[model samples]
Target: MRRELICVVQHRLHDKRMGDEVMNIPRLGVGLQFNPSLMDWFPFLDQSLDALEILFDGMMAPLDGPGLMLPTMVQTMDEVVARFPLVGHSNYGGDFGFDELASTPAVRRHVPLARAFGVPWVSNHCFYSDDSWCDVWSSPLQFTQAEVDRLAVRARALQDAYGVPLAHENAAYYRTCPGSDMPEEDFLARLVEQAGTWLHLDLHNLYANAQNHGAAGYSITRFLDTIPLDRIACIHMAGGRWLDNQYHDLHDTPVVEPVWDLLDDVLSRAHPGAVILEYETESLHHHDGVLDIPRSIDAILADLERARSAWDKAYGPGNRQTTRAEAA
Candidate 1:
């Protein structure tokens, strides 16, 4: 009963025995989307932890060879395993919501990290943006199940090659919202039913859709009810901005009020097995001032904590744990 499946090219399959050990990601984890001023190609860097978004480029031959790849950037999953109290970069998702770099092999090839990073999930945004990706699609907001399926096919192929599942987040499209073959909810649900991979539920995107259109462009509750919950692997929460009467998904500041409400609704229904704060690294520190990162990170962390608390109330503490030892 599958519809569209996408995957990457097959390689020497990684041994499960070689799999990274499972670790519990705290409700609040740091985002690696920021580009640090300092970086060099080396191994076992003790200082690069400051750089955000764990730089992963083509240079790293043996992932665990003599040296670390982008030492000043990526904190090896093994190194960060027990060193840092915060969850590792496994929670990182390329917020290329509107930036499509399909033709760029390195950008498109990031999914293989499921093994390299020991992450339970690898994900990307379903919404297309930026002119750089127009070559792959007719338009950014080309909203149609057919269009989404085309995109999903590419993602499925990556999953196949890596022997790991991939999840696509429902994107908030204000610039190019297209009328779908069916309602957005049904369209998204059918996509998951057709693809065996999984879904990265973004309550923030859903909230944006409702706000831009009437509350019915997609029903927060109905969207939840329709999607095959079993296909969902994680939940994503983030904030945005509004200016000149337009709502933009900045993923920078704290989540808005409506999105927070939608998240509570999500916690009530199917509690996400794992939740992460999708934030922009640009918010890390403004060279011109005393950055307000403490507040921003705290907001994101608080929302994630709230999600966990609500989850405990609904599913009970016994059902919850950070490690994926049992699932894998």
Candidate 2:
């Protein structure tokens, strides 16, 4: 029966007032995209969105009690999505990222897991940056357009087979491939059009990608232009962890400026779905060296607030009048 509910995702974008409903701004709400202990920290988050990283599968498999045993997450997400925020799937596996789980036995049985978890949709990183697996090339962008088409065909098949509404988030690439055929936006737009799905649209990643290449490469503004506003299912907001000279997308930090600019651009163009910052770098049950958890969370929450203000300026009170004035 729950699996039947998963079908709603297919029909959601078609609903008459989806645009208006999506644009309705809400007050402050904290959404968590990583870790369960966050529940203990932010009690009020019960009303916010909670997305689960597929790497969290390890916890879901081995059930037990409340402390931390990787309880059956599919069922858990169903229950949580019912109450506070629902659970959606992030990338499967560790920080490196992997998408093969759609074919794995455990994930296969959990297609209804999204519905069961009360999750309306599921999201994964769009680009191929799986550090754990050597089979796929190091850089997804490096591949030719034909190569991507070949891969998208298979990827979309997995999306359909999984039965959950699926979308891909762009990832931060350190450098551009010398011989890459298509631009990142082209690849992303094609993937969405072909799959008949939407995107998670990680604005921060777009900034990073643009900075690495050049203006000619992947500018955030150009990236936004490439994606049709109607097809953007949901959006993700995250802070990039500045390590060494490169930026790592760790959600623990407050959002930086460039990403904020991109978010403004996106909100001006598309609507927001569950916007949970990827803040999952806390201690795992006090076992992994618990540090200032609240402080870290506050940083992300503050960033979320800033983004809300930016959205307001673009589409909220002031923008509405501006549009009216221009039209009149």
Candidate 3:
């Protein structure tokens, strides 16, 4: 069963790689997060966008147990896959620091879907989730050596099960978990190195952490300098708002100025395979509490343009042809 599944995934994902090996993942360039609201604009986004990051949880339904993908959702996925290169994103299960017995089942459930989507790689948060704690969201793990070793085992197991690369994203938290002795960057570097996994760098999350934790300790410069930039395979850019003196990593607005500056800085140093813009369509702040769908779409396109420009500037204009060809 494992061999057959690996063969299926490799066959489906061959076009995106440089060779027959599944390990040779493609460089996807600039892309946007897939949202239902952007369905109407996809036909026109090819010039500005090079790929789409699909939230796999959105396509799932709780049929009997954990969840399954309905036929309609599969069809939607097919349609999108036919249009652009795809990268899978999920927050359910597969948490790096979660219980192995509990998270393994959920990871198994997602493997077939990842193969079906032909995603070269999939990404999830570096946090842990438990119903006993916050049922709706994940919580950051303590940055200790023991936690790093534990999560590395889980991450490696997940990567082997999926038969593809697994990239873990940094979490934005209000406060450091007790007993976290190491810095976030050091923990991440050690974790990825030990696990043989990739890093799905999220600049906005770093921005939020910097805001909440103060620049003297958790600035972007400190993060980029400490972590292994080459391990970053994918990048996420999002917008947030300051409410009650707290900067929330809310995906509900345009890419803020500071985040854009961070993106530029990261691009100049790290050569990530793709940079994706994440905007939540359902957020009230996203539409300014008004239903101006066209205007909102235009704003998204503008952000894509900015991302593409930055990517081209960093990697050179000639590579745009290669990006378009690969995304085709």
Candidate 4:
């Protein structure tokens, strides 16, 4: 039963009849997170960028507001997609790790907005955001078979409803849950396989987890090896700061040297469709109604270009061909 379901989901996602309307992200191109606050900076951004990953949470209003009706924001987003291709990434209105019933209301409403902007693929973080409700981001999910199954179902439902490929991102956990029955990588592998969904592998998230909790032999390479590389459609790289003696995926700084090295390792093995330089400028807001992004933006784009140059050197230009097993 599970095998049949997996094959069916995969077939629907890869249906070629969907054609160019569906995004085929470049294999070695730089992407940035979409921020309406940075409209002034867009003119200065490198023209070589391949795509934009929009966090629909900020782009659109909550589902309770008349079903996907953010007229002004939708107009802004439409202008963005008109100029560049877009990929969707969200926390699913703060309940991403839960069951479909808890998540689908928001995901369903978000799809029309996404389709309006011509977003072809979307991604959700693998974590819960309900309990604390204090932080800007979500807490790590509890790792167990039940949680895995719940996320798998939600992943499939999201892709089915959107009629576009949806990928689940790995969590950047500071600590492992006591009740975890399996390794985080193993749980993610099972979840992706069960849902037959793609992966939005966040390299910096994996790096942060390794730095914080890998003292007990939790190497990032081992974690990478456990995930099916062929299932990866997008790769994310970000920078963060050390808080309370633990490294967090804060997206506040520039890409560190360690993450740059790991990007090389990832490219040597898997062929992801697009690589994104994920940055968050929400906290940098000033009284002038402008963001403090000049320095950081330049740095982030340079690093992304560096990654692009390195990928071309190693894998050659546009080496996206993959075998059935690798892509499956």
Candidate 5:
């Protein structure tokens, strides 16, 4: 079974890589957080999307348990992979960000998906996902060297198991963990260094952090300047809503203007492998019982159009890497 699975995995990976080659550098795309109601939007999105970032946890089944996914979920995911350049983004049950042991379960789930899709890369957040102790606040763990070592071990393990490159994203935090010495950007740099993983830079997360926690003379530009651009594997651009005086990483909305500017800044400095527009629609149902499929699709297409326009201006046909002064 393992040998057969390996063959299947390699075959799929080859097919997707071929598609990516034709598509060329810096794939413009969106997240496919699978939902029954969103099926109608796929045909429209697949028309132009260069790739789809698949949430790994959503497509799995236990194969023998009650909480496990239905058998058909695998088949459905296979269909989705065959149609698009799919990248795995593992939530990894949230604890992996702090402890290497906690990452094992999440990595086990991701390995099969990586093989199934022939994914070239997989990514996860730099912070924990489930917080039993702190529910009211966005409490991101401290930027400590111990955390960096733990994250590196998990990242390397994932890359080995998946036989693909791995990346970890910088998460948004409303409150800093007590007694952290390193700045956020410096911590990211160290983590990438130790893990030998690429950076899955999430622009909106930085937008939120800067808004809520930025220090004096601090800005997104400073944050960008702190990290090595060459390590970037992909970039996530999304919108958030301000709730209770904090910017939430809620994906129900379109890409806001400030996030776009940050994306442009990154494009100017580095040529990332992909730029993904993340939109979550499950939350929309709360406002109304039904999902407005067409409206949601239209909004993303519009957002992608704006992104393409900005992308073209910054790193389009010419590979323009001019400073603002030069462009002016």
Candidate 6:
């Protein structure tokens, strides 16, 4: 019965073909999260990357005030867009569930950058981060029908504002928030179904959640089975560390083995538009004020190469050949 229901929802979501036509977002292939550390290495790494997931917040100045884009940053962005396709990522966008007027300012700032990059879609965390409500960086949403309905309205408005699709990433939380009526997967399924938003599925976040809460009923397979896989816009792969016996989505290390396995599993089931490696450059800099450029570049390139290889395995010439034959 559950499987049948999942099939029904999947069918509904896919039939709509939600944002592809409206946004004109193409299959971006494999890519990396762009950071300042990688600027000097682009010449060497261009061929290995298919697209770049850019943080729009990073390009702006005086984040709290009227945001400004300097000429130098614009030049840098132009160079990046010239070389590869780009996807916009928002780190500080307010809660999708918040009142539209309160969230609009932060959300509105992403539009120009998205247009400048010509990104097919823009993405943000599923959790809320409005400073007025919380001092912490982010907090998980209460998985309730009411919240889903509210988020749906706000998400659609955001997409309309950008004139492109908006995707929300599954956030990694240490503890489930109280007063949630349903599981995260169900919440996401309902949100996407009602809101017409895409899922910027983060494999590391899923892995972290399952690691911390699997005993209580969270797992990768279950999540994949539940959500509308057809709506997954892209995948985020990153590494984290174990602290206090809980896994953290640190994005400061290389891809872990389990995440790699998860990537393969997701690719086999869902064809996301892109796969991106999110590695923080600060992790490569020593506390002694030295930057290990060579080592940092190698680690990033290695993970990207692996992601590309998996992407190729899933959609390369052999798969294309089979697809063509089937079509014929």
Top model by lDDT, which number? 3
In the predicted model 2, the residue pairs found to clash are 46-84, 59-70, 77-117, 78-116, 78-117, 78-118, 81-86
| Model 2 lDDT per residue over 15-70, tens place | 42322233222222224455664555754333333333332344444222232223
Candidate number with the higher TM-score (1 or 6): 6
> Which segments of candidate 4 are over 4 A away from where they belong?
1-28, 37-46, 67-69, 94-105, 130-136, 282-293, 318-328
Clashing pairs in 6: none
The number of the candidate with the highest TM-score is 3
Lowest summed-lDDT stretch of 10 residues in model 4?
A: 319-328
Q: Ranking by TM-score, best first?
A: 3, 6, 4, 5, 2, 1
Candidate 6 lDDT score relative to the true structure: 0.73
TM-score of 2: 0.67
Pitting candidate 1 against candidate 3, the one with the higher TM-score is 3
C-alpha RMSD by candidate, in order:
9.5, 8.3, 4.4, 8.3, 7.0, 9.5
Itemize residue pairs with steric clashes in candidate 3.
none
Q: How many Å off is the CA of 219 in candidate 1?
A: 3.0
Poorest lDDT segment (10 consecutive residues) of candidate 1: 1-10
Pairwise TM-score winner, candidates 4 and 6: 6
Per-model TM-score versus the true fold: 0.64, 0.67, 0.85, 0.80, 0.78, 0.82
Residue 237 C-alpha lDDT in model 2: 67
Q: What tens-digit string does per-residue lDDT give for candidate 3 at 163-233? A: 77888899888778889999999999999999988899999999999999985477678789999998888
Q: Is candidate 1 or candidate 5 better by TM-score?
A: 5
Tens digits of lDDT, candidate 5, 1-328: 2444345567766745322132223344333344444564445335545567777666665423443334656556545555556777765444354434433445545576666666667777776644231332355657888877776776666656656667778888777778777888888888778866678899999888887876633367777888879888888888777779877887777777789888877888887767777776633322334346666676677887786666677765433222222455
List clashing residue pairs in candidate 5.
Answer: 94-129
Candidate 4 TM-score, true structure as reference: 0.80
Prediction 5 global C-alpha lDDT: 0.65
Candidate 4 structure quality by residue, lDDT tens digits, 89-127: 777444354434444534545676555544567777876
Tell me the TM-score of model 1. 0.64
Candidate 2 stretches greater than 4 Å from native: 1-30, 36-59, 62-79, 93-102, 105-110, 127-143, 176-179, 283-291, 310-328
Query: How large an RMSD does model 3 have?
Result: 4.4
lDDT of each: 0.48, 0.52, 0.74, 0.67, 0.65, 0.73
